[model samples]
Target chain A: MIQLRNALDVFTLVMLIVTIVLLIYTMSVMLMQRGKGKTPTNPKVVTKVRCVQNDYSAERDFSKGDYVGLEIGKCPKCGDTLKVEAIYAVGGPKEKDQPL
Target chain B: MDAGSSSDTWYLILLLMFAISFILNFTDIPQRIQLWRFASYIRRRLIQMDEIESDVRRRLINYLGKLNINSPKDVVDNFMNNYFLIEPVDIEPIDIIKRLSHLINVRDTNVKTYAERYMPGIQKSERYNAIVALEIASAINLVNKVLKHYFKLGLKNNNWVLLMQLALEMPNIIRIVNSYSKALDAFFSGTPIGDGAGPLLVRYLVGNSEPKRIAEDTVYYETLINGRRVYAIKAEGPGANVGKPGEAVEKLVDMLGGNVSRIVTVDAALKLEIEDTGEVAEGVGAAIGDIGPEKIGIERAATKYGIPLDAVVIKMSLEEAINTMTKEVYDGVLKAFERVKNTINSVGEGGSIIVIGVGNTVGVL
Candidate 1:
């Protein structure tokens, strides 16, 4: 009877060890998955402005020191402030300081 | 049975239960994967067709709701852009009539029901006339849609009947010609006349009639207010006489002792659907026929002449300009000119400005 009782005690001890190990492994996995769900915060602030027409030429003959007015609009991509300037004519003279 | 043998039996039972549960869990994986793939395919196709269909539907509903009959031309123009992808094919008159009839029948049925609910007396009054006109417009739009559909199918099957049929329909043919001519006019005539600074001159050296050509050229030269030279060479004439503007520019440059530093070419640009009219966009492209050929020729000539090339493009829609040039459109053009002026300032060489108005100068001074 004592031998039989000792065998039962040994089996119970083995099952307890196995369950504890599994529980620890499951908890670790759940914690790792939870950590991955967080979104990274962005720090940069972006703004957009629409491009409007402005008369920069005093003589209106298209001389130097003239600038195109941009009515700034919000940038569709990255939500940054987009600045649009009218570039040179196609097949026309290139500006010394080209505003891209 | 011995104790050890009984313990071994219990262990085997536990292992069997685990195996059964594992097999059952894995059984659902293939079905889940299939369901996911099917859903993804449907989503992609829906997104692809949604934009085009929605645009078409919006225009159709708006026209139907208006019940106006001023001109079906605008409706056709909008329909071609929103629905038809490219040029219309040749189609038979009978087929076109049949298609139009089918569309009218459907619309009449729907409108009749709608009229009963909303304006029952409209069927007998002037309001009915407006409704009928709208129905006709819808029918015309539907016919265009059908033509587009069949053209695509015909291309795949190499069917000549479809092409010939499309060509036979007189009204459709007229619409196509009118649309092309209007587009050409808008492309050539950047800004509408009488709006800002009035209409500018578009000169063509060659065309269908010499008298017409002379009249056009004379009018262009006579209409100069500020004395800034603006002209365009069209492809409407024979090959020998087609490149007049280029030759004129060349002659002018040579007259100045060939010391030309840079060349500026100005023309009207077609606006995309998303682009607001008068929005200025710059990119390297052809110099004349399109961005490709024009760019190639300009680059080659500039290389030979050792001069720099720049271009200013004015944006407008052929359809919008044809229908009317509102104050807003005129303002847009003035704004574009200002932008052009700024662009020119940045170029230091003080090059000669060649404002080539691209389009048919019909009724334009």
Candidate 2:
């Protein structure tokens, strides 16, 4: 049965409501951010190899000291040289279309 | 008390509250409050920028220490403070590209001299990497200094608008600096960066053929693609450098005596916000991203020889361009390679085409 005696009571009530709303807003924002999670900081990079003589290509996890123009070995398919075609990082931040 | 008396008290108190608020609004107090909030937020970002700058500086010093520099700190500080370029005037617009080209060359020579001064006997490749690392450190330092200057200015002037603008820009600034930090690792390890797409494609095209030095920090290989003589050019690599590809192309056309049929330039282009990474785009212009010297070099060569110029670009974000090459961009480069071959095939058989891979040639040979 509480009633507003003066403007102070009314002001207190308004502040209480505003504080609750802000708390809820902050909590939801935090939860949303947490759900989004962080993108992979260091993605796994791999090197792709291809045999110039045939339709044979292979990929392996990137090793240190790997460079383009490196001749790995002979290809199994056509027995021609398997050279490193590309070395690139994979699996970073996802595309915008994908849902979190 | 009765409801009537309670209502009267409520009205009186409300009037008092309104008076207080109205008086405060007329004063600078409200703006001061907003200023404080924005200032605190910007202060946090400035601290982050400071940490990043310090970390880069520390890494650079450590790297130089390993290189046996007598005073790594002094050298790094000197480099961070002194490495700058005064762009040539463009108001007259006459031979501006030539002036820019000369300035760029002088800047390159100065940077090389600084690198050699500290590490005299280091391998050229190692020296190139050191120069890249120094540039990165200097860049971070520059960003920190600029931001700090504005931040202090804003606070001193009580300029909330300036502070707010800076606060809004903080995220992108942080993102860019973080990417630069990541690029440091790639450079330190000599890993190929995304910008190397052009050079990587050139290496694929050239195979194991020997490369003749064509220009300062640039090389070219004479090879055949689809029965056409293809002179593949790229910045000399396994080091972090973007050689003067434009000058190389100009010299190459002169050497060939205007016999070149077409010139195709491949480079990494910044993608639109909605564009997918690794998208390949074809256009008509020099693909090189230079102030003026490089792009115009390709253009002048093509114009002089009456050779058609074709540009194939691989799309990537700014961050991706500087960081390690991403799979998406690598695939795009492969696609561009095929596209280049197709463009070359369009020229008559036995015709000559100059393909310039225009990008930072790092970790590619």
Candidate 3:
């Protein structure tokens, strides 16, 4: 009778420990999963442009080889037809020249 | 033994209750989160759609109503005060024409009474003067249209030689009429064309050619600035016509033998902010609409041709963009162009870029 009672007590103690361990593991796993989804990736940035002058002339003459040139025209901000030049072309193999 | 046993049973019940409560709370949290997310998402989309629908509705209604109104002061006042919820940075020329037409036709006693009461305070104002001049121009156009029809009919009946002579001189007559219309349009809109300030530069460059030769005009008159061909096309409209910018682009693309790569369309973007100084924004909305059928036709053609479409928006309040264009009016547009130019160059794609400045340049120099 004494041995049976001691075995029963041991069984209850083991079961309680298992339950505690399971609860802790569950909580930790939930927290880890939550942390993974919190951050976001980078978004695409869009650029804008305006034409300030009707007849904008480049301050410096653009050679055929120049990659980009800015035409000094009008100031969009101050309404001043100032020297505002932009990159007009990419001097590379022309689209027609490229063998498709 | 009895008391201790009872206490243990009570403790067991308490733990069981807590366990049940924990389970319920955890289950409820996810459902609550989902509900909140759905609610917020629906709310946001609803608001955006509402805004777009309202704007479209307002523009359509205003355009339809403009031709019928008779008082310039009333039309201007209503437009300035109420037409748009947000003040535009700049007004489009078409919008100015529509408003001017309405102002000239408005015979409302209430509006006239209001104008009379307020005119003394702002009689010398440039805005006021512009409205007055617009009214005068509207009257002139009405008279001219009637006179032209009558004169043409009378000449047709008078003699065959007269009819032939008139037919030969039709272009000149049209030019004179256009000039008169333009001057009136300029005076009211406050963007005089012949004096050389706004759209006239583009129009003179683009509109000089015969209609058949218009397609080839883009290559010579069009400038390749920042990897883009800035082509200007003029077409008749308060509504979009098939012969406008979109058609011109399609014809140009076909001529290039599918070698055309990317297109960047630029146009006036209406701002909703009342106090926003007309500035240009770069991106998609600029080329979306306002060219009528031409815009839709262009989009279809672009899609059919498998061409990539990009846009640059010049920001202006509708009122400012339409009624008046100052030196800084195209400021936002210029900025957008620079950004797009840089982007295209960076990409290093040797594709043809089309930068279209969309608007009615009726009186703009």
Model number with the top lDDT: 2
| B66-166: candidate 2 lDDT, tens digit per residue | 87888999988899778688888878899888888888788889999988888888878778988999999998899899999998999999999999899
- Top-scoring candidate (DockQ): 2
Off by over 4 Å in 3: A1-100, B1-220, B226-243, B285-288, B347-349, B363-365
Winner by lDDT between candidate 3 and candidate 1: 3
Q: Can you tell me which runs of candidate 2 are displaced by over 4 Å? A: A1-15, A31-39, A49-58, A71-82, A95-100, B13-17, B20-25, B67-70
* Candidate 3 lDDT, B79-167, residue by residue in tens: 33222122222346546533542342243233335445544343222323334343433443344444456445644454434444444
True contacts kept of each: 0.00, 0.46, 0.00
**Candidate 2 C-alpha lDDT tens digits along A1-100:** 1454445578789999999999999999999979766655567878888888758998898776567777888999888898877778888775456433
- Local lDDT at B261 for model 3: 60
What tens-digit string does per-residue lDDT give for candidate 1 at B1-365? 45676576567868998987786676765444544454344334334334334444455445434444334345334433232122223365444433543453454456545444443343232233233333434444455456566655645565545544543453344444333333322112222221111122122211111211321121112111133222233322100011223434444445545455455554556666556655555444323433122334445455667766665555655444442243334455566556545544544543443333333222222
Q: Which consecutive 10 residues in model 3 chain A have the weakest lDDT in total?
A: A87-96
Of 2 and 3, the candidate ranking higher by lDDT: 2
TM-scores of all candidate predictions against the true structure: 0.32, 0.90, 0.35
- Residue clash pairs of candidate 2: none
Worst 10 residues of 2 chain A by lDDT: A1-10
| Candidate 2 displacement at residue B318 in angstroms | 0.9
Q: Could you give the candidate ranking by DockQ, starting with the highest?
A: 2, 1, 3
